[model samples]
Target: MEQAFGLVHHGTATVGGRSGITANTICCDVCIVGAGPAGLAAALRLADLGRDICVVAPLPGDGNRRWESLTPGAWKILDALGLGTALAQSHCLLSHAASVSWGDREVNRDGHAEVTFLIDRARFDACLMDAARRRGVRLLTPAVASRPQKIGDAWLLPVTTDQTTVSLCAAHVIDASGRKALTGSRRHRLSPATLALCARWRGPPAPPGVTRIEATAESWCWSASLADGAHYAAVFVDPRSLRAARDEPATAFLAAVGRSSPRWDGTLASPVTACDASASRIARAPGLEDTIAAGEAALSLDPLSSQGIQRALVDGQQSAIVVNTLIVHPERRRIAVAFHAERQAEASRRDSAMCHGLYREQATTYQSPFWSRYCGQDTPVEHQLRSPVPLDNLLPETRLRLSPRARLEDTAVIDGDLIALAPALVHPELDRPVAFLAGRSIGSLLARAFSGASAASLFDGWRADSLPEGTALELLRWFWQRGLLVDSSATDAS
Candidate 1:
């Protein structure tokens, strides 16, 4: 290994195998702060795009030992990141069952069992960072980066390593650092400030292959059996509840657990720990100034959602595309920034509503501050379960016209791995911006909907696009269901 400014360079692993240094200044295409899953994922994707990237942060596996439930969604993301095999080989606990006690005293079993895996977060982080390093991602470990300044088109980050400071410059920076992010200008708290008090224990594992989730007046608790013949439990509560009992947090923690559920009590194995579990998001645009925040840095969701690692990996993948777009097409900077910001906001809103919905269910049973504060006030976007206008019953000659609320707008969309501006059909009634339906451009069809179009004529006209025989009608039904299409007779009657 060659050492440059205290950075060890593995042979054949250089930026082609040398520290990216010139006159003591390290320069790269992107600089990622924080070596967590988010930062490492961004580094891997950026490397795939042929961009020289460097990750600066302290050594991995340094955070408090915490466990995460890796749902099937998280598994898919890990597979995309090429860590699926690694996860399968790891000593993760394969849970076959999970039960929830919310809204009422009855325990409800999850329908989908045998897929979720409980994993040690420290081990997972090590695996991801190792994969990134092997992919030729430059890592400046045991390092700390000061505030970065945008000089010209590059960000100058002062990194301190081995008690010495070195200037690392890059065209863009990724703040994957956790809640206390180093880049995002502001954080918007979506719910009440909450704290999660967790305790790790070693004892006769609570029945094998089962995870328990319950809610009570004091807090909500989650406890599960571990692969190491041990078990762990966590209770989430308002931070204010701990002010008086600050001197002996373990006592308060155990009391909260007992109130939540009797199954969580166990022999204490590690010091009780507390972490922020509130829902929040970056107030500023995600890709503003070419500096993007990923993972917890961009959006932090409540642990009740069981989506922490999943959200972090998703933010990592999306931020990579944003950075790649800004580099490949600087002219499309506005489009890229808009895409990132919109996506971040959309995820925040959706997850926030889902988590709040869960809390809302329990609030019916436990009318406490913890539940009341999380009971979501904002409504989620409505979704249609059944089509209002049935295409099967409509005659071929049925005349349909576009709803006045529907229009075409240019929007930035994910084109493969990059952001591209495309004309998407937008409507006040549509759940999401629709660019295409069943491989057919909604724009081309909507443009013809200006005047009333017969169902037969529309299908025949769009058949040239080679859509399957019934697909065109199905696409029309999609619009009709969303109120983007209205019957010509209804228009005449009104």
Candidate 2:
């Protein structure tokens, strides 16, 4: 690792004309501040591109167990890394069912289709770090990139360890530092406060073909049987609403588990651990100083979706591409940054809305401050979904206006507060939701589409990226139902 960084010793250093410690300065292509899953994944990919990489992180220990499951989307990355056999050898458990306990009844969403995997987060991460190391990733663990500085087009990071501090210089910086970004930039929290307490267990095989999800009076629980004859149980609750022994989280975890529906119960036998499993409140920010934050550092999803690991792996991949573009093709940096920002913002909205919907569905009858506050917002997932709209029934004299609450771009989602969409003229030559239409926002486009144009005339020349006759109407219906596209006269009358 030292050889890769081109380490050089400066025998003596003086500061303020006082005694100072020795220093070593090294240079690399890219420097990663976090060595967890996100950092390692990015390092592996960056190395594949033949980039010199240096990673500064704390040594992985018991903390890795906090990440236990991987949604199926992660398989592609594992396969690409040739870790499919390693993953298979790791005794990863496959779960076919995604069931939820809404109120008192249990509902299985997947009907037992194979999808999610339960693996040892500790082992999986260790394997990833090992793979990255083998690929020439210089890891300096038990070290901190606590502060990084930008000197011209390069980044200078100060890494501190027990023995000495090392200086790392790189052309680009990747902040895979999870939520506590090394840059100390704060993220916005979208949902009401929530956290998870998870514990491991050894138990009998769970019911075939399903992972059980349960919602209780004050919290939610998820228990999955692992491939290696073990099980994992996690409980989600608002810390304020929970008044349990902070020192004995295992007992609190057990008590919460006991309250869940009994369909997939397992005996709790391992020590419990608590961690923040909240969806990232921080929306993906525009690229700054060529530094990119990936995974939880970029956007943390709700655990209810169980897609964090997969998202992290994918985020790392995307971050690598972004970093590569910035270094290899500086002219394309603007395009790459825009794409990353849009993708991340969309993911954040999806996670927020899905979580809101999941909690809202469970709280329809039961009334509790815990659920009420988080589920109180309107979720736009159902609204964003494509459904049939009847543009054929439009009145020639009818006019439309963008809803006061609508915001648009090329890609759109229901943010907690307003509807977000991207405006683009659908054309036959374009891909789905194709190229950015300059100066287009949802409101302006909708206003122009129906402005003084007859219903037949509006539909006559419309070519929105290969929409079947009925599909276009459905898109309009989705917006109309949500009041994103409203009748001008009707709105004025009201």
Candidate 3:
């Protein structure tokens, strides 16, 4: 079987004939729109499977610019695509925890979370494009795929660019055009309480040991030092508080933050850069005939959870799997439909709960029109506005454990009674034992025991007293670092 892919550049041609341009023509088994991480990932994965893939995107230019932050999962996906090391060297790894404070109470606290990265969107997109090119995926830049048409069982895409128009035929089309280019009538609108403004800045070296500091009032303010010593800060505000600053954007938002906490004073400086902030709900149609949507085009979640990047990668990878399956089996289209439906439902549940919770929390403190509209003195109003579903309901079902499930005894005999038992465990009464008499790392021991080697054979020559004092602790730490072990209480059980 053969496949083809195409990428149309953004802003190269107006699809509505405003630019007096004709459509270009091409043919491929699969045509992917958008060249961001998701689209590029789909292209690369499909190409690796020996399918014809075409990637379309806007030509490298100043008009099509984007700036956003990527969470930890983004790095993982990039690495999987062979760009991880380069991105790690270039982007700033956010190491600090994120705190949300309101009044005297801290509503939320995330600790030791290192899954976020702040990056320049242009550079990141370029990197993906280069990777896709090197992997044999066809690329079409400075091109735009206009209204899609149905021709028998296939789809015909009319693409346009500055100098020419082209027609591309494909059995399937994946839309990664994002929200701005969505062709569906259904729309996801964010709550009025959600708003964000961000900009880049060059400032004095960030205060040592300070990675990110956030303050919450009617909204929240986040400040962090980039890898290059530059600082980037964003203020998320409610619509009401934002209106109060109609005449002065940065000043009003900064003042709101300053009034909530004095710490922001040091971070908010003159010549502060700013950008307009907007929020939207997540919405999508599972599959429109032969056309499928992925990435931001299919669904958008609240940025509060910082799950945007992760979801994009997941969607990209899942979409690739779906397309490949459909190409091979042809009869399993229903499975792909069901998969997307489940994804949309989960995204909707999560986005709604997150935005509502944030809006309500802020509303309780600030007595502004925005807060009042969303959250007021009415107990029923507040309670009714509460999230319909719990946050845990959004997590995907995976086999990875957050904590070790098995317990090791001080000493126990293995198969055949060939191994001897000893009970010299210190602090045996505590939930976590400080030391084990066994002279070996528990993880290493577990690895050996699970490797088809009998416990007796492996431990027969082991010397309990020869083990170092911190060997077990070191092993546990290693397990934690590798995500092989989890703290039971870190996540909700259900």
Top candidate when judged by TM-score against the true structure: 1
lDDT of 3 by residue, 143-249 (tens): 77775666665666776766667666677777777765444446655444356655444555653223443544455666566555655666666655546656466
lDDT of each: 0.76, 0.66, 0.56
**Model 2 scores what on Cα lDDT?**
0.66
Model 3 RMSD, rounded to 1 decimal: 13.3
Ranking of candidates on lDDT, top first: 1, 2, 3
Residue-level lDDT of model 2, residues 33-80, one tens digit each, is 887667888898888888999888775556316536676678877788
The residue ranges of model 2 lying beyond 4 angstroms of the native Cα positions read 1-22, 61-64, 97-99, 103-105, 108-111, 202-210, 243-248, 263-267, 283-289, 378-386, 389-432, 435-494
For residue 362, what is the lDDT in candidate 1?
A: 83
> What digit string (tens of lDDT, one per residue) describes model 1 on residues 327-423?
8888988989888888777777777778777777788888887788766456464353444655564667878787777778888887877899778
Order the candidate numbers by TM-score, best to worst. Answer: 1, 2, 3
Backbone Cα, N, C clashes tallied per candidate: 2, 11, 32
